[model samples]
Target: MKRKGLRHILLPLLTAVMMLVVSACGSSSNAGTNGATGSGSGTEAASGASQEPASQTASGGTGNGEPVKVVWWHSMGGELGKVAAQLVQDFNASQSEIQVEEVYQGSYDESLNKMKASMDSKSGPSLIQVYEIGSRYMIDSGAITPVQQFIDAEGYDVSSLEPNIAGYYTFDGKQYSMPFNTSNPILYYNKTLFKEAGLDPENPPKTFQEIKDAALAINKTGKTGASFAIYGWFMEQFFANQGKDYVNNGNGRSGLATESMLNSEAGVKTLTWWKDLVDSKAAINLGRKTDDTKKAFLAGQIGMTLDSTASLRGIVDGAGTNFEVGTAFLPKADAADKGGVIIGGASLWILNNKPEEEQKAAWEFIKFLAKPETQAYWHINTGYFPITTKAYEDQRVIDNMAKYPQFKTAVDQLHATELTTATQGAVMGVFPEARQLAETAIEEAFGGKDPKAALDTAAQAITDKIATYNKTVNP
Candidate 1:
């Protein structure tokens, strides 16, 4: 459900924008013009604050004994934004050598675009949060300093971090960023509706055929069976669930991906099954927004739906006093499918243009955020599971899990996932645009176009974009 804004801009235009932004950085009036929009009360200091140059110090402190300042740009909004702001407040209060100012940029796409436009300027943040799909682009941009350098220099023990979550950010045996918020898709169903439809409430559908059968049964009860949003992420997850790669070159882990495998047999099977459900009146094709489908499910208009684990808190609260909400692992294309879910959400990256002291300070803040206590608070407050496994042992997290057993399903599903290239996720510089193309393909298939034909066209378009991106980065 991440909102990716704007289409892909060529690298030439991006370079020109960077030059313009850097030239404008000399103006004092434009110091913090690129700061946060009003999203959190705790981030008042980050909105239009003047930028001051820092002097080198042995302990990452300013020349006048002031704390080193670190600016963080993020895309978390609403309740999540509040939680992020609270984290920043806690970190700033807990330390004296470093101070953090958080700015809530727009969605993931907007934040990444802003970073591209400002990376060469003084207005760019020392630390920024980018979505999972932006990993390849960020790595290729040559504007980031890999967090692995800090881990190695400080001898930090990373064994506590969830491997499956960290795997997405790791490249060439090196960790590029610190995983902040991680989630996976899950099946949410109304237990009351399942009972009314005479389906087993506890035994939710485990495979595509079973889901179809359950949906047909629910529809026979004069209610809609399900409504799945036409999300491209789900399509990627389905490929992983079937132990299939979305792109070649080891899911783009070993090397740059030259093509997309979106039209493979796995892809055709998944879309055909989904389109069949809609055609047979077993499911509704809710457009591109998962929000619309969430509303329908909460209103008891649909029996089951698919959504990220991050939505568990909001969904459960919305369904309160109405019906019991049952959570299950994401359905697979076949009963024997051995693949599992890929992690969603975003991670924190350190920009290379910042001074060494500021980068070190940003690393300190990142370490504080990864602590078990902090992760537990984040997990309970927002439905995102903790990236650190030790967070599960915290009393608060334990109690929260016991109270809302649905949350445990996500953790269990993550632990059950098999670590492989497919599950680690595909990487490409043009992933944002690729997702939009995938969504278009889904819409076309729903409009009566053959699933394979639609996927082939979309896959080719993604391949072309990948080639263009590769040339831009390599040339």
Candidate 2:
């Protein structure tokens, strides 16, 4: 695909975030409590007990033999869940050979855990959405048929897939999974607060120093200054923007990552900068939870923050018409740095044990979800950057961009990022645990510990964790 426009940059950043989530498993057998609830308003129940079960597909269509029912387990809920349901409805209505039943499997971790249990019992869904961090473990588990296998066997035209986004999932010329919901981090600021503080509302901070300057001004107005969740994903972004790797072996793109490099000079510099910001009262210690910091932003308690682009809709709805919200590229550590941000969000994988017909039916549904029209609909409804290169040209997407100019800023920033290994993201087997350690290290730094000491402790801990994980998977 020809790379053009701000939309082009999303693929690389998207790949990075997907490469950071780790694997999950559960012992639960009950689907209802395993985070399987119905989509949105009608079926928000915990067990995800659907009104339309597999029987509907068996009885609904003709001439295509019995319509095959393909179960899709996903982690989306709330507003995003509504959009997912609509996509399934449209796909089901557009054809008769397949019927997709989307089961809400809680958060990414919860869904993967249930999926692992289901696989062990040989009753897993036809397709499962796994976060990027779990990619290494997923490949090691030998549970799913690589989407690349299907693509190659069917001679599928995957040219429509965004390269940087697709690149993250690709290893040894094989795309392991299909890119689905994708996003990047951005700096969100309250324009009204900026103006109140006599800072230029139009010019948001472009670097950490500028953020500190803006935060100091905003704090003088008696409002909380900038704040962010102590998230490993954002820290990964900070590292990527500095052209630094999160883990060894080409950020785990080239080979198995056995250790973390987050305690190096780059890591110390980034963490120390964050620590100084906190010490000067220019940034808030919003703790480790992302939701807490998001609330702080939406409640107008804080003037600026760094968060995923996915939060755009919620911030819009929560802040209402009383104040204007603005978004910019996540402020760089250095203004002249060539590094770019990484993308966050998950992707879809097809399971291996399903019957041939069932597998094909699942692929059909997956391909349908990748269409430009479908991507545009999803993008407009959920704030996730569309995965298809052409989706941006769709009228709906164009209209939405015009309506919310802040959304366009994300596209521009994404296009500005150059693709590189660091920006491609890290793929560690114990990435989830590693991320927690990173977050904990940041929290320690925020609490006034020496940044290098805190990071060194976390780095050493991850190295030990990786060694143990490698034994189990590689043993």
Candidate 3:
């Protein structure tokens, strides 16, 4: 959808062109202000040991000469981390022309910060995996070439890519990055606990009221009830599920976002319901730590939890013998609401400062990653939905989904979701900041503050941030 707003159209053109000019003159990390509205300070902590593979020679290639080296930085860890490493190993073994070195760069927020720092010194990696929230900032950074340019130049057929998954990284009808590991939020319940509580294990809650009722019943049976992370992403998902915009200008997809709509009636209703659930002990306050909540559910202490489908493999494996992990769509705010959840995952982008050979090699690596067979392997091993439509037809994927039906929930939910502005998810440049503010509001409500007052406070703060960001980026 094209935004009617002048700023949305002009700003991107200005941002992209101006950023390129700045790079031509003298590239600096602060060159273009990333065309992002906020103060540009990264809030996430960065810490981890960055490793370099022992072999310096290109391990895989067409055997013409030394393979081109492509440096890749990512944020995956644990079992998912293992799978990512294996993919890199396989990719290296597949060809004799290009070798990719995968580096663990802490969490999403941290990696972004690190990437920016690297760009400032003109020492960034050949390719970097950035989360969906950083899409706008990445575009403005002028540090990477848009994946669309590669597609157009190579005439690569990307019709096989899932529209919803591809939609999140698209702006102005152009795809900025390649969707690699993708996921959506889902309801994960402990089937063993459900049966013990006299609830039908097969029939999971489909609405907020049903969730509350189920939680109450489970609690009455001496179980811990439903609990989830105090994640800002969940707030965005709730608003989308109700077909409500989280910000102005078509959730910032059409134009530059200037304000937050998180204080609207639907927003209040959702926050209030969340606060009441916690207040009544139907939902456990697991704080902002995702691992803590996952551990709680895996230990069978909590009967239900909401998390990304990316967590499915870990949860199922962790919950062994303790409980049967059941999956379902995230409950709607109201039974009458007609909306769906948004996709959540990171994508790959090739840096612009790299050599042409490295750039082409990076593109080759990206193409390999998107192949149906490779994506199928990734989906089955990591519980992330495959990006290509053909990946589902792979025998491995078919067998995996049949063996563990929980993994199918995300694919089913994605197929059922109605494509709309809300489900396209927010594209605001200051979205990360807005999400942090929403999380603060959630914490305040859980701390006994009035839901309306809390959201209003956050909404106003978000408005101020958006205005500042707009001015800073476009002024």
Candidate 4:
């Protein structure tokens, strides 16, 4: 049963403080301190010092020698990170002209910090694992040379690219980065638990109420019902389903002011549902749990979880998880509530240095990574949906999905998703900090603060953060 924690009581005030602390601790903005290169928000590939500025000779700083190392940095972790490492090794072995080096740069925000720092030093790597959230910041600083230029320069086909993905990485009608791993959240359920709950294993929750119902039913078996990683990701998807906004100012990009409208009734309703679940002991509170809710779910303690498709690989490999773990599109409040979820996972951002030859080589490797076979491998191994069309068409992908149909939920959801201000993704400077605010707001409700007041405070605090960020970034 979900039990509220002590932190929940002081959530509104405490959440704001925690966000400040976390952001101060690791928030990455390319706005380096007086060009000292203190931090960059992208991954860095530690390429060996094989080619020097003079050793490389190519037009436009391409540095086309006997194929110097193309260092690539990413924010991938777990199986996702492993798959990327494997790809790097495979690329290095495939040809002698280019060597792609991969490095694990921590989580998405940490990686962004590294990338921005590298840019500040004027010696950044050629590739970074960027996300849709910071695309505006990257474009505003010109930190990234548009991947499309490389695509055009390399004569790659751009028409096959998904228009939604094109919109995701675009600003002012131009593309900046190559879309890599793209995933949205899906409901992971235990079919065996469903049967125990007297619910149909083939049927899953269809609405928020249904979600709670399923949780309550599952809890009847003396197991905790539901678990989730981050509430903001789920919140974004919730708002998308309702056609609401988390913030205005075009999702905090364009350097515009963003009002935290998540304080609205819709948001409160969503949080109230979670609070009810917690109060009902049907949902597990993450702070009090010994094992993470997802981990618990894998271990049969949790009946359900809502996480990104990236969790699929781990879920598949989880020990003592014999129940048929199934996946479905995130249930909405109603059939009329049909908006799609915002995407997660990261993208590839080319750093601002290196010769044209190395950039071309990096582009080549990225394209290779985007190939159907490579994408298939990535999806099967990492559980993130392939960003390219060819990946889905590959026979290997087909075969893998045929073997495990649960993996297809993320892909199908991405294809069916619709783009709105709410679901298009975010690009504020202090996003990680903002997420803490949302989390704290819910913590308060579970703690005993009226859900409405908690959300109002969260919205205000987030608004204040937006203003602070704009002042910091714009001024």
* Each candidate's clash count: 0, 10, 9, 22
**Which order, best to worst by lDDT?**
1, 3, 2, 4
> lDDT (0-100) at residue 135 of candidate 4?
59
As a whole number from 0 to 100, the lDDT of residue 250 in candidate 3 is 91
**Residue pairs in collision within model 1:** none
- For TM-score, candidate 3 versus 4, the one ahead is 3
Candidate 2, residues 43-162, lDDT tens digits: the string is 121121112211112222334677888999987776567778878987887767688999887766667666665654668799988766767767766667788877888798888777
Q: Which candidate is the best by lDDT?
A: 1
By TM-score, the best candidate is: 1
Over 340-418, each residue of candidate 3 has an lDDT whose tens digit, in order, gives 9888778998887787778888888888888888887777766678899998888877887887788778888998888
User: Better model by TM-score, 2 or 4?
Assistant: 2
Task: Give the lowest summed-lDDT range of ten residues in model 1.
Answer: 36-45
Q: How far is candidate 3 from the true structure (C-alpha RMSD, Å)?
A: 7.7
The runs of at least 3 residues in candidate 3 whose Cα sits more than 4 Å from the true structure, single-residue gaps closed, are 1-66
Measured with C-alpha atoms, the lDDT of residue 37 in candidate 2 is: 17
Model 3 accuracy (lDDT, Cα): 0.76
Write candidate 1's Cα lDDT for 1-475 as tens digits.
Answer: 0111211334444444333333333221111222211111112212211212111122344556789999999987666677788888878777678889999886665677678777546589999998787788777766778999999998999999999999999999999999997888899999998999999899999999999899999988888999998878889999999999999999999999999999999999999999999999899987876767888999999999998887776788789989999999999988888999999878999987788889999998898889888888877777677999998888878877887899889999999999899999999877766776888899999999999999999999989878867776565
Model 2, residue 173: C-alpha shift (Å): 2.0
Local distance difference test, per candidate?
0.80, 0.74, 0.76, 0.65
